[model samples]
Target: MVQSLNSNVCEERVFSNIFQTLSKDVHNFLRYKYGDNLNPKDKVQEAFIKLWDNCKNVSPEKAKSFLFTTANNMMLNEVKHQKVVLKHQQVKPKHYTNETPEFIMEESEYMKKYQRALGNLTEAQREAFLMNRIEGKKHKEIAEELGISRKGVEKRIYGALEKLRKEIDGI
Candidate 1:
């Protein structure tokens, strides 16, 4: 019937709108909360699928909350399983025999200083810096992930760099 077809079209449009609005937010939320343990993209996709499946029961206003909660619960279950695996594993140390003792000692000292500096940074600055530098994310990507302006991301990264330089130079 035409009525049934119209209802289906409306439901599809609503689902599409929800996906566009909350997919990135949900992905970033999972990634930020769980760090590297959870695959955020996968979690986002799974959450959206569940939302689509339960579209009749979920309202537009509540879709965001439902997606986030579902993704979080999925991540928590994954973390629990990972914890079990990690408990049974032994971590190995990396060795470099080509470097001189003095060079190695100096490098170690510098790394320690760097870590201390990083630890002293504000949470925002540290998160922005790590995402940009260590994870190879661009300023725009960092901004999106942190839900801030691109300029804000740049400022945080620059501030972190300046603080680190001062800390390391003073050491």
Candidate 2:
């Protein structure tokens, strides 16, 4: 990127130049590979991160090749992972509860309300509650993750649940 620059890709000016020169091409390449399902921007960033991590080893002449190779390998790995997930899904038994249309509509409406109420909660309360219930983490684990006391995590979760119940159940 930096014309006639030294071999050190780690240099801030050289690295910035490289990013300015290659980011668009890299992003376009990734987007062409995955139009919507996957995040091409994330892939570009990850590729750049790999290049930065190996800056000491990668020469300016070889940086482009290294990035493309790393990105291609990552994409292949993701494709393989998706295939495995699809295979598992195919093998897994499917179950359905065919409730009445009226019931389904009512359930959907209730879910809208529930989502709105959930979003209305304070950020701390929602984070702790979701970490505990959705992630199945213990109060102690949530505390450690949030860098707060167990009591604090408990309080946030309790407050969230109380608000949700009141909003959803009209209690």
Candidate 3:
């Protein structure tokens, strides 16, 4: 019957639509749950295929739940079979007390040069840089406090950095 044929076509369209819509969401969900080590795309594909095979029993509304459940179970089985290895690394703390006289002189000179460079920056640039670096204010916070746009704050900070780099490099 034409009605039966049309119904079949409609059902296929719904299945295809569900696959396209839920595939990305299902992939992201799996990726978030299992991390980047597992192949989420493969899981998504397998889930959709399972959904297609059982399309007779699943409505379009329940398709999302079915896909997520299938992907989760697949991921769990994969995780269970795999051995988890965690490597611990010890980081050595830096000690600053072992400086030679030449090193101390060089560090002091660098600080003086840095101060000179800060003195050379434009007032706007200097204020923005200090607020960001010294006062530790975010761009948005500095922008609000200075009555400037975020972009303006960013430009000022960038300009200050460029000027300081040039001065410090002796260019």
Which numbered prediction scores highest in lDDT against the true structure?
2
Candidate 3: tens digits of C-alpha lDDT, residues 44-112: 899888887887776666678888999999998778656442222244567767889999998899999
Whole-model lDDT values for every prediction? 0.84, 0.85, 0.83
Give me the runs in candidate 2 sitting further than 4 Å from their true place.
2-5, 94-171
Q: Which pairs of residues clash in candidate 2, taking residues 3 or more apart in a chain or in different chains? A: none
Q: Per model, how many backbone clashes are there?
A: 0, 0, 0
lDDT of 3: 0.83
lDDT of 1 by residue, 85-150 (tens): 787675666666888999989999989989999999999999999998899999999888899999
**RMSD per model, one decimal:** 19.3, 14.7, 12.6
What TM-score quantifies how close candidate 3 is to the native fold? 0.43
Task: Please estimate how well model 2 matches the true structure, expressed as its whole-model Cα lDDT.
Answer: 0.85
**What is residue 94's positional error in candidate 3, in angstroms?**
17
Cα TM-score per model: 0.45, 0.51, 0.43
Q: Show model 1 residue runs off by greater than 4 Å.
A: 1-10, 90-171
Q: Rank the candidates by lDDT, best first.
A: 2, 1, 3
